[model samples]
Target chain A: MSEYIISLAGLTKKYGALTAVDRLDLSIRKGEVFGLLGPNGAGKSTTILMMLGLTEPTSGSVQVCGIDATMHPVEVKRKAGYLPDEVGFYEHRSGLENLLYTARLNRIPVQEATERAYLLLKRVGLYEVAHKKTRTYSRGMRQRLGLADVLIKNPEVIILDEPTLGIDPRGVREFLDLIVQLSREEKITVLLSSHHLHQVQQVCDRVGIFVGGRLLAEGDIPTLSEKLFAGEPYIIEAGVQPLPDTARLQTVLQDIEGIRSIQFSEGLFRIGCQRDLTSAIAGAIVRSGLALTHLQRKTYGLDDIYNRYFEGGPVYEQTA
Target chain B: MIFITATLKEDLSMNRLLNIVALLKAPPAATGRAPHPFRAIVDKEVSDHLRSWRFNILLVLILLTCFGSLYISVTNIGKAVKPDDPDGAFFFLKLFTASDGTLPPFHVLIGFLGPLLGISLGFDAINSEQNGGTLSRIMAQPIHRDYLINGKFVASLIVISVLFFALGFLVMGLGLIIIGVPPTAGEFLRIIFFILLNILYVAFWLNLSILFSVLLRQAATSALAGIAVWLFFTIFYQIIIKLVAKALMPSEMASGQAVLHYQELILNLFRIVPSQLFSDATTTLLMPSVRSLGPLTMEQVYGAIPSPLPLGQSLLIVWPQLTGLIASTVVCFALSYFSFMKREIRPR
Candidate 1:
C-alpha cells in the first residue's frame, strides 16, 4: 500500500481566463490530519471540491485511497466523506433522519443506517435533539451535527472545508478537539480547511498555506517557520523592575555569543537570539543585578508565519 | 413443531438486524441492487413537497378547480344526456369531462390546474437548494448530481399523479352515488387514459419549471419566468394565433373550401399550445360520441355513424395530440437534464 492515502498531482482548475487553482501537487498520508490554510479566494474550497470530484479540475488528478477521484468519483466517495462550509441539512428533517437520508444515499441498509446515525448523533452530543428538526438547532449544534453527518458512513478519509467558520471560540475549541479525536482515536485521515489559524494549529498534523491559487508553504508549522523565517531571529522577552538599570542590562548581554541584538524600553528587554538561550539570558540578567519580573521565550506561531508570507515577505514574492 | 422452530429463528434474526440498524444507522440493504442511492433523495423530496406550504396551497387550488368544475359538470351531464334516458350509460366518465352552461368541462379545469400545480412544485427546486447552501453538501454525498435532480422530478411526478388519480376516482365515485349507474368498461378505460395524459401534460410544465430553476440563480426570478410562460400559453397565445390567422386568410371567403382552409390553419395554430393538446386529447377520450373535431364538407359527413367510437378509434384520432404532449414533456426534461449536467455547481 502507498504511504499517502490522498494525493493530488499537477491539479489545476481554470474558469475561463481566471485560474481558480493553479498547478498544485499535494499528498496526505493515511491517518494524518492535514489542514489547508488560506485567505478567502485562495482556492481552498476549489481544491477541496476538486479532491472530492465535485468540481472538475482543468489539468490535474486527485486520488483518494488509491482510487482516481475523477475517473471513479463514486468509489472515492465511498471511502471519503466531505463536510462543506456552512453545512445545511434538510430543514424539515430531524437530525437523525437527515443523517439517515445521507446514509441511504451511500446505499447503506435502512435498519443498519438508522443505528449508526443514532450512535454518531450521541457521540457528537446531539442524541437528545436527534429527533428535533435540524432548523431548530443552534449553529454550533448544526456544525456538530455536520461532523456526525460526515462520520455516519465510517469513511476512511474525511475532508472538512472551513469547519470552524463563523463559529464561537468555545465551539471552535470543541470542534478542534473532536477533529483531534477523529484522527488520533479513530485513526481516520482528515483534511481540514479553515481561516482560523488557531484551529489549524491546534488540530492539523501538517498544513499547506495557499495564497492566490498557489501553495506558498506546505509543512509542519515549525518547519515552515524555520524555512521561511530563516534570517529572522527568535525573541526572548524579559521584564525587569527599576527601569534605571536598562543600560546596564544591554551591556551585560552585548557580548553574549549567540545574542544578536538587544532593545530595552519601559523596563522591558527584548533579546533577539540565534537559538533558545533562555538560561544564558536569565543568568546574565541575574549577574547584571536586575530582578526578572517576567521571563518568557516566544516561539514563532502560525500567525507570525502567515503574516510573513501573506504580507509579501521575500519568500512569498520570490514564489509569486 | 416445525413452524414454531422456524418462527423462533426468524424472530432472532429480525431482532439482530434491528439492533445493528439502530447501532450502525446505515448497514447496506440486503439486496442484489446497490440499494438505489436515489431512493432516499426521492423519499426526502416527496416528504418535503408533501409537507410544504406551497404544495398545500397548490393542492387546495387544484381541489377547488376539481370540485367546482365537478359541480357544474353533474348538472350539465343530466341535461345534455337524452331526456328519456335520465342516466347515460357512460355516466361516470361524462360526469368528469362534461360541460355545463356556467363552466367549461372538467378537462379544461384540469388544463388550468395541472400546469400551475406542477410549476409551483418545481420552479424553485434547484436554486432554493443553492440559496440555502445545501446543494454543495448534497453534492458531497456518494450519489451523482443526476440522482438529485431526477429524484426530485420523479418524486414530484409521483405525488401529482397520485393526487390526480385520487381526484379522478373521487369524482367517479361521487358520480356513481349520484346517478346510481356505473360506467361501462370502455368508459373506465377511457378515463384512465385521460388521467395518464393529464399527468404527462403536467409533467411538461414540471420539466419547464425545473429548467428555469436550473438556469436562473434566484428563486423568485425562476418562479416569475415559469408563470410568464404559463400565462403566455394559456391566455395571450390564442389571441395572437387568432390575429395571425385572420391576417393570413383570404380577403373574401366565398367558398366552403376557403372557410375550411382558414379553420384548419387556426386549428393547427391551437395545436401548438400544450393546454390545447391536453384538452384535445381529453375531449376525444371522454366524449367518444364525437368522431372528429376538424371541419368537414357535407359530402364527407354524409354517411357518418352516430354511435360512440371505440376506445382504439378514439386513441387513433388523438394519437398526434397525445404524442405532442409527451414529446414536449421529454424535450423539456432533456433541456433541464442537459443544462444541469453542464452547470458548474460552484456558488458564483
Candidate 2:
C-alpha cells in the first residue's frame, strides 16, 4: 500500500478567469495530521472539495484510499470523511438523530449505529446534549458534534475545512487537543485546512503555507523556519543594565564573528546571527563590566514564518 | 481547448452512465449490509413532512374544503336529480362537482389548493438544505447525490398520493352512506382516475417548485418564484388569454365554420394553463358528458344522440389534455433533475 492516504497531483480549479486552486500537488501521509494553512479565499476549501470529489478540478487528479476520486467519488467518499467549514446539521433533529442519520447513510444497521453514535457523542464530550436539538447547540458544541459525525464513518482519512472556526479560544485549544489525541489513538490521517496559524501549529504534524491559490512553503515548524532563515538562522534579545558605552558594545558584538544585524529597542538589544552566540555575547557583556539583566534565544513560530514569507521584511514581535 | 473540452464532455457522460449503473446496484452503505440510503433519506423526508406545521395546516385546509363541498353537493343532490334524467345514474360523481354556489365544487377547490400543496412541499426543498448547511454534509455521504433529490421528490409524491386517495375514498364512502346507493363500477373507476389525474396535476407544480429551488439560492426567493408562477398561471394568464380571444374574436358576419375555428383556437389557448388542462381532464372524467373539449361544429352535433359518454369515450375526449399535463409534469421533473445534477452544492 502507498504511504500516502490522500493525494492530489497537479490539481487545478478555475472559476471563469479566477483560479481557485492553482496546480496544487500535495500528498498526505497515512496517520499524519497535515495542515493546509492559508487565509480565506486562498483556495483551501476548494482544494478540500476536490479531494472529496464534491467539486471537479479543472485539471489534474485526486486519489483517496487507493481510489480515484473523480472517477469513483462514491467509493472515495465511502472511505473518507469530510467536515465542512461551519458544519451544519438538521436543526430539528437531536444530535443523536443527526449522527444516526449519517450512520444510516453509511449503511450501518440501526442498533449498531445507535451504539456507535452514543459512544462517539460521549467521546466528543457531547453526551449531555446528545438528545438536545442541534439548533440549541453552541458553536463549540456543534464543532465537537461535527468531530463525532466524522468519526462515526470510521473513515481512514478525515478532511476538515476550518474545523475550529468561530469557537472560543479555550474551545479552540480543547478542540485541537482532542483532534491530536484522537488522531494519535485512532491512527486516522487528518487534513485540516485553516487560516489560523497557532491552531494549525498546535495539532499539525506538518503544515503547508498556502497563499493566493499556491502552496508557498511546506514542512515541520523547525524545518520551515530553518529554510526561511537559512542565512541568519538565530534571533536573540538581551536586556542590559547600566548601559555600556555604545561604541564599545557595538565593536565588541561586531567582533563576535557571526552577528548579522542588531537593533536596540525599548532598553533591549535584539540580535540576529548565524549560530548560537549566547555564551560569546554574555562573555562580551561581562568583559565590558555591564550587568546582563535578561538574555534568551527567540524560537520561530508559524506566525513569524508566515509574516516573513508574505511580507519579506524585518521580523516583528510575536503577537498572540 | 476544444479537444480537451470534448474529452471532458465524453468523460462526464461516461461518468453519468456509470452513476446510473451504480445507482441500480445497492448504495455504498448497502454494501455494509445496511438499508438503502435512498430509503433512509425518503424516510427522513417523509417524517419531516408529516411533522411540519405547514403540511398539517394545508392538509386541514384541504380536508375542510373537501368535506364542505361534499356537504353542499349532498344537500342539493335530491333537487338536482330528476326521475327521467339519464344523468341520475351518475349521482355519485356529482358529489365532487356539485355545489350550492356558495363555495366552489370539490374539484375546483383542489385545482386551487393542489398547486399550493405542491408549492409548499417543494419550494424550499433544496434551497433550505443548502442554506441550513446540511446539504454539503449530506452530499459528503456515500450515497449518490441524486438520491437526495430523488428521495425528496418521491417522498412528497407519496404524501400527496396518500392524502388525495384517502380524501377521494372518504368522500365516496360518505356519499354512499348519505345517498344509500353504491356507485357503479364505471363511476368507481372514473373517480379513481380523477384522483390519479389530480395527483399528476399536483406533481406538475411540485416539480416546478423543485426546479425553482434548484435554480435559486434562497429558500424565500424560490418560494416566491414558485408562487409567482402559480399566480400568473391561475390569475393573470386567464385574463391575458381572455383579452387575446376578445381582440381576435371573429366578425359578426363570419361563417359558422369560422366561428368554430375561432372558438377552437380560444380553447387551445386556454389549455396552455395547467389548471385549465387539469380542470378539463377532471371534468370529462367526473362528468362523462363532456363529449369534446374542442369547439363542436353544427354539423358534428346535428344528428348526435344526447347521451352520457362511456368511460372510454370520455377518456379519448380528454386524451390531449391528459397527455399535455403528463408531458409538462415530466418535463418539469427532468429540468429539475438535470439542473440539480449540474449545480454546485457549496453555499455562496
Candidate 3:
C-alpha cells in the first residue's frame, strides 16, 4: 500500500461564529492526482491554506510528508508548493524576475535560479514573454507564470487551488497534461481543487467532493459512482435515430422488477437498475425485440457523482 | 572497532562532499552572492518606491519645498542686513531672531519640511502593502514578522536621511555662492546639528504616519488620517492648549507676570504633545538666547540669565517623547503584523 504523504486529522477552522472548515479529515497518498471538487465558498481555499500553513486551524493538526505542519510549518512549506486561486505578482517585476525572486525566497542560489526560471518559463510556453512586466501579461500568461513560480523550488507536493480558473480550454488542457506529466515523471503528489468537474474527471486519480465546508464524499471514480448510485447501473447510446417514447420504455421496464429509473436520450434509452438486475435488463431488452445493438452497464462520470452527492437536497436536513 | 570508525569517517566525508555539491548547484542569491535579508528587503523597497509615480510626485514636492525655502532665505537675508548700515556684521544676528530675535535658517526649514517628507514617506507604508496584495506573500516567507516591519522602517529612515542631507548640502552650497562670506565654524556646526534634529523630528513623524498606516487598511484612508492628525497638531493643538490653560489657570495676576506664568503653563502642557516638544527643542537649538516668547520684564532681562542647557540635555528632555513616538510606531506595527498574519488573502 502507498504511504500517505499528506494527512489532516479532525481539522477545524472557525472565523468568529462561522465555521469555515469543520472536523475535516483527509489523507492523500504519494503520487496521486487528488482533486478537491466543490462549489463556490465551499472552504476549498481554506483547506488549502491550512495545508500550506498560511492559516492557523482552530483545532486539530495537519501533517505533510510526516512533518507536523502546525509545529513545523517552515519545513512543511519548504517541501510543498502552493498556487493560490487568484495569483498575484509584483507588477513592477518581469515574469522571469518574479520567478527568480520566488526561487531565492526558497533559498536557491541566483545563477541556478535564473537558469531554472528560464527553463520553467519555457516549459509553461512563456519563454518569449519572460522579459515583459507581469502587469502586461494576459490572465492566461499570468496563470502559467504562477505555475512556473510554484515549480521553482521543485517541491515534492504541489497544492494547486483552482488551477484552471480563468484559463482558456487550450491552456487548461496543456496545464492538465503538464500536471499529469509531473506526476508520472517526478513522482510528485498533487492536490488540485477545482469547480470544474469535467476537468477534474480528466486528470484526477481520486476525487473529493466538498460542500458547505464539509467533505461529502471521497473515493476513486468507480467507488464514488457505486456509492452514490447505490450500485445501480445504466446503459447509454448516442445517435440521431428515434427511440421508443419514455412512457413505453417505463411501462416495459416497470414489470421487470429491480429496474429503478428509465431515461430516454435523443435516440437512446438509459436503463438504470438494481445491483443484480443487469441480467434482467438484458432479458427485457431482448424480449422487447427492439434492435438491441448496444447493451452494457454504464459507469457514472464525475459530474453525475458530483450532482448526486452535492446538489439539490442538503445532505442532512435539520429543520422540521 | 577501528574498522567501524573508518567506515563512519568515510560516510561523513562523503555526505559533506554531497552537501557542498548541492549548495554549489543551487540557484544564486537574488541580490548578489550571499544576499543579506535586510539588504534585499531595502533594495526591493527602494526600487519599488522609485518605480511608483506617487514617490516621484513626493520627490518633486520635496525638491520644490527645499528650493523654495532656500530661495526665500537668500532673498530675505540681505533685507535683514540693510546696505550702508554701520552694524552690517551684526546682520547675521538678525538672521537668528526670536520674538526677541529671528530663528536660524535650517531651523525654519526643519519646522517646515520635516512633516512634509515624514508624512508623505510613511502614511502609505503599510496600507500600500495591504492594498497591493504583497503583504501576505512577504509574511509567508520563513522570516519573522518583525523583520518585515523593521526592514521597512529602516529603509524609510534611510530614504528620509538621504533626502534631508541632499537638500541640506544644496542649501548650504547656495548660501556660500550667494552670500560670498563662508559661515563661521560655529554657525556651520549649529546648522549641522539643526539638520540632525530636523531629520529626527521627521523620523518621529514617519513613525507616527506608519502607526496610522497600520491602523487604516486603505492607502487613501491612511494618508487622510495622517494628514488630519498632522493638521490638528500643527494648527488646532496649540490653540486648544492655550484656551484650556486660560480657563484653568488664575488670570488676575500682574500683566507681564501673567504672560510668563501662562507661557510656562502652556509650554508644560504642550510638552505632552510630540509636535510641540519637537518644535520647542528645535526652536531652542536655533535661538540660543531665547528666554521666552512672552512679554519680558527689563529687570528679568537685565538680571544674569542662566546659560542655555547643553545639547545632550535637550535630547534627554525630549527622549520620552521620542520614545513615545517609537513605542506607538511599534505598537501599531505589532497590531498590523498580528492582523495581517491572521487575515485570509481573499478577494474583496
Per-residue lDDT tens digits of candidate 3, residues B190-277?
A: 5566667667777777777777777777877877887887788778987998789868776566586667777677766777666665
Q: Which sections of candidate 3 miss by over 4 Å?
A: A235-251, A262-271, A275-297, A312-320, B1-33, B78-113, B176-193, B212-215, B238-249, B253-265, B268-273, B291-302, B306-309, B316-321, B342-348
Q: Residue pairs in steric clash, candidate 2?
A: none
Taking chain A of candidate 1, what TM-score results? Answer: 0.85
Candidate 3 chain A, run of 10 with poorest lDDT: A311-320
Residue-wise C-alpha lDDT for candidate 3, range A1-320, written one tens digit per residue:
23999998999999899998988999999999999999988999888878877778999889898888777777787778777766778888998878876766666766667666765776688877887999899887877887788777777888888988989999899989988886776688999999999999999999989888888889998888777777455534322123667676666567777655666544556666665566666666667765566665667887777766666653223111
Specify the poorest-scoring 10-residue window by lDDT in model 3 chain B.
B94-103
TM-score of each: 0.86, 0.90, 0.81
Instruction: Please give, for residues B82-116, the per-residue lDDT of candidate 2 as tens digits.
Output: 77665667988988888779989999999999999
The candidate scoring highest on TM-score is: 2
Predictions in order: lDDT: 0.82, 0.86, 0.70
* Candidate 2: stretches off by over 4 Å: A238-256, A261-270, A279-294, A312-320, B1-33, B83-86
DockQ of each: 0.42, 0.29, 0.15
lDDT of 1 by residue, B207-307 (tens): 99999999999999998999999999888998999889878887673687777888898998999999998888888888787677788788878997666
**Which of the predicted structures, 1 or 2, would earn the higher TM-score when compared with the native?**
2
Q: Is the docking of candidate 1 incorrect, acceptable, medium or high quality?
A: acceptable
TM-score of 2: 0.90
Ranking of all candidate structures by their lDDT, best first: 2, 1, 3
Provide i-RMS per model in Å.
5.7, 11.7, 9.4
